[model samples]
Target: LIGARLSGGGGMVSVAAGVERVGVLLEGFEGVEIAAVNGPRSVVVAGEQQALDGLVGVCEGEGVRVRRIPVDYASHTVQVEEIEEELRSALAGITPRAGRVPFYSTVTGAPVDTATLDAGYWYRNLRHTVRFEEATRALAAAGHRVFVEVSSHPVLVPGVEETVEACGVGSSVVTGTLRRHEDGPGRFVEALARLHVRGVGVDWAALLGRGSGWPVDLPTYAFQRRRFWLESGRGAGDPSVLGLAGVDHPLLGARADIPATSGVLFTSRWSLWSQPWLADHSAAGVTLVPGTAFVDLVVRAGDEVGCGLLSELVIEAPLVIPEQGGVQVRVSLSETDDSGQRTVQVHSRAEDAGPGADWSRHVSGRLAPEAAHADFELTQWPPAGAVLVEEAAERAYQDMAETGYGYGPAFRGLSRAWTRGDEVFAELALPEEAGKPDGFGVHPALIDACFHAGVFRSSDAERQLVMPFAWNDVRLFAIGATALRVHLTYQGTDTVALRLADATGAPVASVGSVVARPVGTEQLRSSSDVSGGRMFRVVWDRLSVRSVEVGSGFVRVGSV
Candidate 1:
C-alpha cells in the first residue's frame, strides 16, 4: 500500500477503516490507539492501510460512507472515547506552562493555552466543527502578507483564494506541492526564491522535506522578423481620368474645368459679402443711411486710431440736431492724388443751396481720417430757474416710498440739516410715532433707513454724497420710546463717522469707519479668477445684516 506517484508535487496520505480490528488480530486482541485529534468533528487514526481499508469496507456495507483520510493515523474514536474520563483525570494531574508561539484550538476559532493542549481538549475537538475558514480569515485580517498551503497536489490553493476573497482579506496565497512532479522539488525551490525576493520568505525545506533533489536549469530563447516592399509604375492617360472613378489621387490635374470668374460667382452667393465696399461701388459715393454707412465709417476710423479709445463715442440713442430736422448721412473722403495730409469735416448748414437773405452756419472742427468720430450734446436753451430744495426732497421721498422699504411723507419729519463750510449740521422734529425718548436710543434697522434718506436729501443740497462702507463698534443704549435723532460727519471721501442720538443730543449708537469708492452693479457682479487671471460673474442672492463685527469688511448675510 506504500507507493509514490509523480503528479504536481506535494503528498496525500489516506487511512482506511477497520484499524481497531487489525490491531486486535496483530497483538492478540489488544485495544486500538488514537494518535492525533485534529479538529472537533474529525480525528486522525494511525494504523496499517490494509486494516484501514477493511474498516472502510465494513462501514460502506453498513450504508455509511467511510472516507479514507489523507493521513497515516487512526485518531480519536469510540475505542479512545471509552477512556476519555480517565484521559481527563490524567490531564488534571499535570500543571501546564506558557509558551512563546501561540497554539490554536481547532474546536474554537481562537488561540488556546499551550498547557491546555491535552486529552480533554482533544476529546472535545473530535465532535466540533473544524473552523479552518475562521482561523485563516483572522490570520489574514491581522496583516499576514503571505499564506503557504503545505500539502500534496494543487487543491488547497484554489480554496485559499476563494476564502480570502470571501473575507475581503488582502494577501497572496501560494501552495507548495513537494513530491508530485519529477521536477516538483526544483519548481518549489524556485517559487520559494521568488517569494523571498518579493519579501515573503517562505520555508520550503521545512514544509516539503530537504531530501527532494534539484534538476538542471534550462534556458529558453525566441526571435521574430518583419519586412515590407513597394513598387511604382506609369499609365498612359491623364491622371485626372482617375477622378472619374470618384477616387482621390495626388497626381490628378491641377486646373478645374470651369472658368475662375464663373467659379467665384457660384461661391460668392454663400460667402460673407463686404457691404461697405459694395455700397461704395454701387452708389459711387457715401450713402445717406446712418446705420448702414455712418456707423461702419465710424468703426473703421476708430480701428485706425485705436479700439478702446473710440468705444465710448458709439451712442446708443439717435442723434438730434438743434434747429433743423435730423438727417442721417455717411460722409467719406473723395479719392485724390495729393500726398499732403487732408481733413474730412462734418458740419451743419442752415441755408438752402439757393440764395438766402440771412444764413446761420456752423462748421465742425476738422479732424484726420483716423479721428473721425466725436460726441456732441446739443442744447436749445438754458433753464429758466432751479428747483427748490423742498421740491427735490419731495421727489426723493416719493421715489423711495414707491420702491418699498416702508418710507412715507410722515417719516420725513425725522431730521433736516445743512452745512456752510467745513461743518455739517441738521436738526428736525422726530415723528411722534417714531418712539423718541428723553435720552438717546435707536433701532438698528430704523437708523440705517434714516441714514439712507438723509444721504439722498443732503446729496441734492451740497452735491456731495455718502455711500455705505462698514459699520463698527455699534452699541444700543437707553431705548427710545418717542423719537431718535442722527449726527453725521466725514473727513474727505476716505472716512465717515456717524452717531444716532436723542433730540436732547445724548449719544445712542455710532459707526466710526472708512468708505471705499461706490461700486456699480457691474463691478459687484464680477470677480477675478486668480488662477486663470480672468473675470467671471459671481452670482448671489438676497443679503441682510448678520452681526456688526470690529473688522475692515462689510457684514452681509446670505445663503450660498
Candidate 2:
C-alpha cells in the first residue's frame, strides 16, 4: 500500500479552492484530510485506500483533474490513528531534550521547545494534519529568511516559497540541497554557491580540509577550460569520422556486426595469461570455465538485443581452457522477432584452430524482454512459514567438496538457508576478499552460491548429489549484487525455479527454472581435461643426432 495516491472530493471540482475549502468539503468522509498545501491552488488530500478510491471517482465525475501522489502511508489523517499506540510504544524509551537551534513543529503549526517531544506528542504528530504552510510562515515571521530543503529533491521547496509569499515575506529565499535526476555533487556545490551568494557564512576551510587557519586563493570555477578566443589555422577534425567501436567486456572483445541478420556477435579469446581467474576455477588440475560463466555470456548477449531474459541455455559441452593457448569465444545473438525475443548461443574453439575445426557449442538459449518481477515479498527479513535448513547451513559445502567442487574462498558465499515444503529461502554473499567483478550482472561466485543451496536434499530425494546443467527464463532486474536473499521453489526432483533479491530484499534477478543433473566426481574430472597441447618427448632412434651440422657453410653432400 506504499506509494499510493489519494484525491479530494465533496466540493466544486475546479472552483479554485485551498486547504480550508477542501477540508470543509470532506466533512462526511472518514480518515481523510488535506495533507499539504503546496501553493494557493496546489493542495494534496490524504486518506485511507478505500476512501481515496471513492473520492477519486467523485472528483473525476465533477471534472477535477484528480491524481494520486506516490506515498506509502495515509499520514496526517484519521487513518494514522490506527498506528498511534504502536508509534507511542516505539518512542516510549526516548527522552526529549532542549537543543540550541529553535525547533519548528509542523503538527502544532508553530515553534516548540524540544522538551515537549514526548511519546504522546509523537503519536499526535502522526495522527494530525501537516501544517507545512503554517510552519513555513511562522519561520519567515521569526526572521528566518533562508529555507533550505534538506532532501535529494525539492519536493517541499515550492510549498515553502508559497508559504513565505502568503505571509508577505517577499524577500525570503528558498533553496534545496540537491535537484532530482541531477549530478549529486554538482547540485550540492550549486546549492552551496546559492547560499554563499545569499550571505550565508560557510566553513570553506573545513570543507577544503585546511586545518592551519591560513587564507588561500580559491578558484571561482572548479574546472579549468581551454579558451578558444583566438582563431586557429588548424582545421577541425570531421565529426563523422569516428573510430572503431569497442566493448570493454572481459569475455567479449570488440563488438562485431552479424553479416546476415540484425544481430551482433561479441568475440574474444581467453587464456591463463589473460584471465588468471580461470585457473582458480578448475577441477582435477584441469582448467574449465564454470557453468555460471556461460550464463553471464548469454545474459550479456541478451542485453545487446534488449532481451536479457535468458529462457533456456543447455550446456552441451564443456569449454576447457588449454595449458599453453586460449579458447576463442563467441557470444552471438540473433535478430529479435516481433515479440522482442531472440536466440542466443555461446560457441568456442581452440584459438589457433582453422575454419575446418568444429566449434563446441557450450550453451544456447532464448532471450526476451525482462519478465514480470518475481512474486516474492522480501520486506520481512526472513519470510515467515519457512524453517531454517540446519543441515544445509552446516554441511552443504562439505557435501559439494566431496563431489569435486573444491570451492575456493571466493565461491563459498552460502551463508544461511531455510526451507518449507518444496520452497527454499537462502541468504548468500561473497566474502569481502572476493569483492565484485566489473561488467557482470551477478558474479559467478554469487550465482554458484545459489546452486550450493540446492544441495539440500529433502526426505523425498533419492539422488545424493546434483549440479546445475541448464537454466531457463532467466531475467535480471538489478545487477551486481554481492549479497542476495534467494527464494527457490523445487519444480521437480531435479529442477527448481528461483527468485533472488538484494540483502534488503529488493528483487535482483529471477530464474524461471534451473535443471540439475546427477553428477559424479569422475564426470567433472573428465570434462575438465586439457586436450590439445603436446606434452610427450618422441625418440627418433640413432638418426636424430647423426644429422647435426654446426655451420651454415656446411652444405649437405651425399650421404652422411
Candidate closest to the true structure, highest TM-score: 2
Q: Runs in model 2 with CA error above 4 Å?
A: 1-244, 280-286, 337-339, 354-356, 370-374, 391-394, 433-435, 458-465, 520-526, 529-560
Best by lDDT: 2
Give the residue spans of candidate 1 off by over 4 A. 1-80, 83-96, 151-155, 181-188, 202-560
State the weakest 10-residue window (summed lDDT) of model 1.
263-272
User: Each model's RMSD to truth, in Å?
Assistant: 41.0, 19.2
lDDT digits (tens) for residues 447-484 of candidate 1 = 43334334443343343222343333233333542444
Q: lDDT, candidate 1, residue 427?
A: 38
Candidate 1, 47: how far from true, in Å?
A: 18
Cα TM-score of candidate 2 = 0.50
Sliding window of 10 residues with minimal summed lDDT for model 2: 6-15
Q: Which residue pairs in candidate 2 have backbone atoms (N, alpha carbon, C) closer than 3 angstroms, thus clashing? A: 2-72, 3-71, 3-72, 5-69, 311-473
